[model samples]
Target chain A: MGDRAKSLRNTIVLIAGLLVFWQLMYAVIGEVAMRSPWQTMRYTVTLVETDFFWVHLTNTLQAFAVALVLSVVLGLLIGFALGLHRLSAEAMEPMLVALYSIPKITLYPIILLAFGLGMSAKIAFGAIHGIIPVALFTLNAVRSTKPILVKTGRVLKLSPPAMVRSILFPAAVPEIFTGLRVGFSLTLIGTVLGEMFAAQHGLGYLLMNAIGLYNVDVIMSVTFLLVVFAAGVNGILLAVDRRLHFRV
Target chain B: MRRVRLYQVGVIAGLLLLLEALCLAGVIDKITMPPPHRIAVDLVKLLLAGKLYPEIGKSLANVLLAFGLAYSTGIVTGTVLHGYRTARETLDPLFATYYAIPVFAFYPLFIVIFGLGDGPQVLIGFLLGVVAVIVTMLNGLDRVPRVLRKTASICRMGPFETAVHVTLPFCAPYLLTAAKLALAYAFIGVIGSEFIMARSGMGYEIGYAYTNFDNATMYPLIVLILLLSIVMNGVLTHWEKLLLARRGQR
Candidate 1:
């Protein structure tokens, strides 16, 4: 059989295996703390219908949207500025990477103090978390563009701005999209962590609030919602990436 | 490169000096940020008086242990996934998607199951870190050219022999890269769990200071965290450079 067909079959089998494992764990524990896969799935559907859940979900989404746009705009500008010059790019790359790798979540306390317990704190935290990776990736994307491509643009007597729009931007779009995916994920994590640490509303706040009440169902359901949402968004991003990442 | 290096150092020093000047002139709030000189002095005192050692030890121990666990499990899982081409294709999407999801929400669930303290802490750290290692290993192993498999058969080598002689050596550098990234994530995971709740750890100490609004202690702790991150990053860069130099020689 071809690899693709075999792989799809394997995926179905793996999903079945995961389900069995979840059920087995639930059986062994038989505790509310460890809900069955079926239970969490059912609870997830019910949670989606509630007004309270919607409010928190909206808050999380809003933070994500703001952070995503801010990070992308800032990342492109900074990345291009640095990436165009070899000296600046090499000197700054390490710092950018260090900042990106370390959990900026550690800086949350300072952010909370500065921005208060409002949505602003979450937005700032999420933006910072997302910005570094996007900027670093964009820098890399720009730096790695083919020299031949740029030479061809010059040969055609294209203006610098036109060169960027046609040659540089298109050549780097694939990597920029990779950065976007990473930024999206980090932004989600930042927003959730911010809400958990200090926020009146959001999925993270709800998760923590549920913990205080020892509401196991809510915790599992919330987690389920987060996973589904992340997977859905990632799938869309992946599709977009594949379409834009043309092989030259 | 040398000039750029000097420029970078100078820029960082200039920024620090500016911050020090502002704090010295009382331009910045003392409560929000103590002067750099004072923070340095206080940090030395905390280290000398043995106030922060136990917390550092606890956090370090958790990170190392969790990283060890992650390294082993991540390697095994990656190997298994890669061993079956179909499995590799199937699981790749799930793992990639999960790279973004907040695994922290499960901390409470872990607390309920493991009864808090170090068990849940280490487990959470392992979860956070293992993904990086697994993905690296899978990619590395996948990149081992198919020619090696053909060569192995020509030489009458068994599966074990082929893996050890061809596949393992080929991916050694990638494995090292994975180790570096895994350690970084392990520390982040360990510290994060500590921040949330821990009997003793750097993270727990930071959490304590923040809750009490103890700026005196918080600033120094943050400085310590920054130092730790810089040191880890330096080690990884040095190791990678050494590896590349050694490879160039061969």
Candidate 2:
């Protein structure tokens, strides 16, 4: 406990030092090109109180939530199908990986053409980007389940469905969680990219507006909020992963 | 082996033929989804006009420069941080924050600071690629076996020699994984930045086509970019396999 505390203290100190260094660099760069650290903070606080800020925040968050839910559903279904049947897995894996390897942004134009520039396009884009990781990871996890475990379950005369539920699903849960984490991150990236390319409103639009007006402080403030939101999302996922990653 | 390869080629060809048939049958509109032949013709025209090569060259240069900067800095910084656990812990939150903060959000700031040029594009790409590389390398360092470290020390190897001969070799797979991921991210970073604000590049061409509603041109550009990514990934994976084979021999 003492050692842990000491380590934590050292970490805090180092973080503080880095922040100071960042601020000093900003000071040296001056305010014409980039705002000072204090200026960015003040601007961030001011923006936080605005009604438009909340609306945009809600818009981005809603898109992200819908994307996340859809990805989890689709990923699990497809992953299960691929994992359960070896012949299907062998036939489909290459094509799936090929599609996955394609830079998703390349699909943006096609998606926009099909879905039009609206929430649907954003949601679909996010879902496509998010689903690949989950499907790939889950497929890998299920395929890698120990042969010994399957044999033991069969010897015990467990039913097929029971063996899967009792052995396979639990065995793959850790890897599934890893996929979930990656899927969530990709979802956020896709949503942000979608909004940036063409959107009427959201954080991406707001940032673009600030850029148009040359409002450096607002841009910096929005960037700070985005960073904080992303870190928070990652932290929550990490905590969930830790809690649910129990071995069979 | 021959049969399997032939089957794979047949499948790909069949898919292409099916797509072409759909376009010809008007099940898919040619305007929105052009046939492969049309795209091929357009690609040849663009190449002959000398427009495609320059644009591709510009984009490739930007990606390579940005990737090089990010790779060097990420590896060096990652190595140093791994040596000092205290430093790694301190930077962990910062790295997480930066990673999460869609680097795209700061495109405007970069443009403002560096102006509307390759400067900001490369900077954004480097920023995006470097963060992922650092995290991956750090994780790789942590996973280095304790036995390897003990053996190196017992052999009286100096710190620099140990790192070069033992630590780096062990982390080869992890580094390759990082390189693969970083390449993708760097591509997105550069293209996305260019899409929003740029004068010339493949991304600029696509963005121009979009504004003009020239789906024909836009579709071909997108195809080119996708092909580039596929080729790059195949090359990198092959390189990694060769490295791993050599390491295994060692």
Candidate 3:
């Protein structure tokens, strides 16, 4: 108990030290760059309070949300189809991996041309980038599903849907969750990239505008918000993962 | 199995051919989505002009330099953090916080600090690549077998000797894995930076073409970037395999 307490105290001290170091570095560099920590904080707060900030935030979030949903739905369907059959899995696995390895960013122009420069374009781009990981992960998860469980379900004379629900889905939950996390990260990247390429609104557009104007403070503030948002989303996923782990 | 593999390739090829056909048929508008032949011609022109090679060189240099900086810093920091568990616990969350932060979103800040040159691009690339390495190295260090450490200690190995012989070798596979992921992240970071603010890299070329509505030129640059990414990923994977084999001998 004493050792644990001592360790905890040491960890706290280390965190404090890091925070101090960060602040010191910011202070030293901030004056030269005109981007002090205090200034960034002030800007961040003021920006958040503005209605203009929320409009851009909402646009980006809406596109992101739609992309994520589409990717998840399409990914799982394709993954299941590939995973359920041995021949399909063997044939498609290499191609899937190759496609995943390709920088999907190159397809942005093609997507933009197909879908136009609206929200559809961004969503389609995001979906394309985000879906590959999900499919790959789901395929792996389903391939790893236990034969014993399948046999047991067969012995019970379960229906096809019942077998999937009780055996396959449950068994694949952990790996699917892993894929979902990766998919979420990729979705964020895709959405931002889409916005950067050609967009009239969103945080990506805002950041681009800030760059065009050379407004470092606004850029920094937007970046800070994105980081915080990503962290928050991650935290939520982690909490859910933990809860599911415990329940399972 | 072979037939299925062929089918998969055929499908992808078919998709590409369909797009080409559509452009040829004037259904998709050739100006907006040029046929594959036009893209190929543009690619040849870019290559013949000796413009493509220099852009590739510049992008490669930026990626490699930034990756090297990130790898060295990550390894050293990871080692130190791993040696002190309390320190690792404290720093881990902080690193995660930074990692979660979209490093690209700070392009403006980076441009302000390092100017609109290669310095800022490399800085952004390093920031994206380093965090993953640090996390992977730390995880690898934590999972190092206690028996190996005990054996080294029994041999009267000093701290530096033990780290050199035991810790680093034990962490080799993890470091390699991290390096692979870091390469991908670094590539994206550099390309994204160039896309947003660069004037010379392949990304800048793509951005320029898009703005000018030069679909033929843009397609070739996009293909070049994609090819670069694929070739780099293959090289790194092959290198990782070789290193893993060498480590297996021990």
Candidate 4:
């Protein structure tokens, strides 16, 4: 309870510090380039109520949902396949790490070329950004499962799939959850990035459009919305993540 | 290890051959991608022509600048913050959630304030990288043996001497890891911002070539960026392994 209270206090202090920083920056940069925190909050409230904002929000959410599902499923399949085979894992892990570190935004052109300009392209881009981390984490997690458990599974003469289901997956759950949390964030970033370029609708498109009009209010409010959503979801996942790690 | 390398080479070669075959068979149209070999040839031709050197140079310089700034500042800040437990704890949540928050969302606001120049791009790169470096630094510091500090105290070494001779050397592998991350993030942040709204850079050139449907230019540029990043990462990874292996030997 004391630890929880300390953490809660820390979080509150962090948020307050950030708000103060924002207000300080707003003062320095002035009204021309940025909106104050209070103004941004007010505008965000108004922005959330608008029908136009909902259209973009819905589009983004839909793309993000499909992309996330695809990423997790495909990432897990790849992870499990490679993890189960020592030779394949040895050969592929470095390549995956290299792929992960690349500036995938450069690949946006190729993705656009293949998927064309719309929802599918955005989903593909997001999934591409997301899949690597999930696969990498899951691969490590599954590989590191307790040797005794695997020996026990072998003693039972369990089939490969059954062994994985009964032993590996459960053991790897915490680390896999960490990957999913990271994947979630990267997928959101990728989806928004895809929309920023040559898209008719989405928060990213709205951002670009507002920039063209030099609309400080819209930019701040939208940026604020994105940060708030990303940070809030991440904070919740982080709490769960810590709990899972502590359990293990 | 040799067998693993062979398998990796085989896998990459097989994929490229498959892509080449698909392009040759017209199963994948020319518009989508112009075969891997063609991309290679174009890359060579583009390099030989030297038409885009300025943009490439500018982008590379910015990446290095961002990386240098992030790495130096991050190390210093991390070292300082290590002594301030309360501050570090208060900042923990921010560090935890930092990457999750898209740094690019602020690009528009940056453009507004900095007016769409190199400042925003470099700033974005620095922002993306510095936290990673700081986190890595903190992690490295946490593992430093108390015996080492006691030895420094016994020797009557000052803080600077202690850091220079002891802690920093102990943290070499972590510093390399931080360097790798900082460089990668710098590459991503700069190239990405350039892709979005820059007037000139390798990313902007790719965007330009794409809009004009200049597949020759676009494909080559994309291939160039990929090769550069992969090579840089490979070198850093190799160096990091060497450091780790040496440490293990001791």
Candidate 5:
């Protein structure tokens, strides 16, 4: 309880510090390039109230939701399949790490070419961004399950599916949750990145549109919203993540 | 090990072959993606032609600059922060949630502040990488053996000398891991910024090629970037493994 309260205080202080830094930056740069924190907040409220913003928000949310689902499902399947086989896991782990390190943004053009500028492309891009981390984490989690647990399952004459359901899945839940948290963020980033490049709808597109028009208010509001949404969700997830880790 | 290698090679070759077959069968159109062999040939031709040498050079230099800046500053800051427990604690939340926030969203703001120049791109790369380096460095510092600190004190070493001659050397493997991560983030930041809105660079050129329907140029560049990142990551991974192996033996 004390630790939670302290963490809450730390978060509030961090947010305050960031606001101060933003205001300081705004003062130095002036209205020509950016807006003050007060002005940004006002603009964000107004922007959120608008139907135009909602359309883009819905589109982004829809894509992000689908992408996240796909990433989690595909990631878990890949992870579990490979993790069940020691040799396959050994061969592929390095490759996944390599893939993870790659810029991936450069591959946007290829994605555009393949999926051809629409919702599908955005989801695909986001899923690619997310799937690897989830898979990598899950792989390690399953692989590292206590050997004694597996032995117990085997001694009971449990089938492979039964062994996984009863033991591996339960053992790997915490690590897998961490992976999902990470995947959630990366998927959001990837979706926004996709929208930024080729799409005509979404907050990322709106930001790009604002850039072209040099509308500082729109830029600040959208960016502010993205930061808030991402950080807020991640904070909640991180809290849950900590509690889970602690329980274990 | 050899069987594993074969499996890896076979998987890669199989995928390439599959893609080639798809292209040849017209299941995948020419405009979307050419055959694997065609892309390889074009990449070789593009390199020999030296058309994008300047852009490639500019992008790599910026990545290196970002990596160096982030790595050095992160080490110093992490070292300093390690001494102040309260400060590190206060800043822990920020570090944890940093990557969750899209650093790219700040690119536009950086562009506004600094203009659409190398400054914004390099800054993005640095911002993306610096936190990771710091976190990794702090983790490394946490594991520094107590006896090592005792040895430094027995030698009557100053803080600076202890860091240089003792703590820093002990953290070498962590430094390399941090470097690898920093480099990758640097590449993502610089290239992604360039892709979004930049005057020139491989990313910008690729975007330019795409808009112009120049698949010939675009595919080769994309392949090059992928290959560059993979090779760099592979080399570092190998080096990291060797370091760990040596440490294990010792």
Candidate 6:
């Protein structure tokens, strides 16, 4: 078989194996809580038919989109500013890493307290999650741009602004994109966490409701939709990355 | 670098003082944004009253247990996946997009499985930590020289011997990086889960304070968490530098 064909075959086999194991567990356990793959699949389809699912999903996405855009714009500006000077970058690097290590999730209450339990709180929570990674990585990428590239700009008689706009920016795009990808994931998580932590609306609220009522099927369905949404966005980004990384 | 380091410290200190003044002067809401001085006082009181240490210890214990589980599972599965090209191909897509999925989204399922206790918290922590470890370890494994495998075979080395002498040495740096990443993830996971649902932990304390509008207590706990993670990251950074320096010497 061709490499592509073999890969497809392997994936199918692995998926089949999982389904069998899932079904076997359900059969053996004979428990309502332990849903089989087929049941979860059916629940997943049924979930889309409901109006609340769309509402919650859209709210979550809206928060995520706003946070991501704001984070990128702010992060890029801050990163460029901080990264311009090696001395400054070096000085703040440790602090940034330390901050990144701290779990922003725990601060959800404070975020909500400051912004209130509305869309603002969710966006702020998510933007906080996305911003640090983007800023830190962009700082590193810009500051660490190869000296050879700067020399090229110098040889071209480019001014500082022109150099940054042309040479430095292009060189830094790949890494910034990398940070954005990480940011996107974190922001989504943050947004969901905000909802889940305590919100009047969003998929997270729906999830909490399900948990409270011991609605296993709804919980599984929501989780499935979450995965699908995440995978779709991530896949699109990866495609963009593959195309962009080489050209610039 | 040295001069800028001092500048950085001074800048951060100045910012904090400004924030402290802002809160104290009522420019910022005192109730919502407790001044640093008051938070510091709360911290001292908490320390003196001996209430903070046990919670710290509990959180640390959970983190450690989860980290151990994740590190082991990540290593074993990473190794297995690396050894099997077809299986790696089959599962790599899911692994690639794994982080995008909100881990807490599955908290309900976990609570159901483990029944609302440390079991669920630790399990979630492991789930978060293990993904990073597995990805990093796989990257390390990818960099293992083809020549090493050939040499190991020529020397009649068993799979175990080759792994220990050749693979482990080659993977050390990446493993270290992954371990640090995994440690951070594990800490985040456990603490985050506590915020979601837990009987005790630093996150719980913060959640508890926030619900009751106890800003004084909440602010101090938040600061404590910040300090703890910073100290931990600092240690990891120091070790990474030391290892890199030692390697550079060769």
Task: Name the top DockQ candidate.
Answer: 4
Give the TM-scores of the predictions, in the order they appear: 0.93, 0.89, 0.87, 0.99, 0.98, 0.92
Given candidate 3, what's the lDDT at residue A35?
62
What tens-digit string does per-residue lDDT give for candidate 4 at B96-184? 99999999999999999999899999999999999999999999999999999999999999999999999999999999999999999
The DockQ-derived docking category for candidate 5 is high
Q: Give the Cα error of residue B12 in candidate 4, in Å.
A: 0.6
**How would you order the candidates by DockQ, starting with the best?**
4, 5, 6, 1, 2, 3
Worst 10 residues of 6 chain B by lDDT: B241-250
Chain B alone vs. reference chain B, TM-score for every model: 0.90, 0.87, 0.85, 0.98, 0.96, 0.90
Off by over 4 Å in 3: A1-22, A31-34, A90-102, A246-248, B1-14, B25-27, B95-99, B151-167, B239-250
Residues B110-193, candidate 6: write the lDDT tens digits: 887668888888888899989889999999899888999899999999999999999988788777777777778888888998
Clashing pairs in 5: none
What candidate 1 gets wrong by more than 4 Å, as runs, is: A1-14, B21-27, B146-162
Instruction: Assess each prediction's global lDDT (C-alpha) against the native.
Output: 0.83, 0.81, 0.79, 0.94, 0.93, 0.84
Query: CAPRI band of model 4?
Result: high
lDDT (Cα, tens digit) per residue for candidate 5, span A14-130? 889989999998888899999999999999989989999999999999999999999999999999999999989988888888899999999999999999899999999999999
Please tell me which model should have the higher lDDT, number 2 or number 5: 5
Candidate 3 docking classification: acceptable
Clashing pairs in 4: none
**Ranking of models by lDDT:** 4, 5, 6, 1, 2, 3
Predicted structure 2: clash tally: 0
Candidate 2 residue-wise lDDT, A175-211, digit = tens: 8988888788888888878887888877877888888
Best by lDDT, which number?
A: 4
Cα misplacement distance, residue B117 of candidate 3 (Å): 0.6
The full ranking of all candidates by TM-score, starting with the best, is 4, 5, 1, 6, 2, 3
lDDT of 1 by residue, B213-247 (tens): 88778878888887887788778777777776787
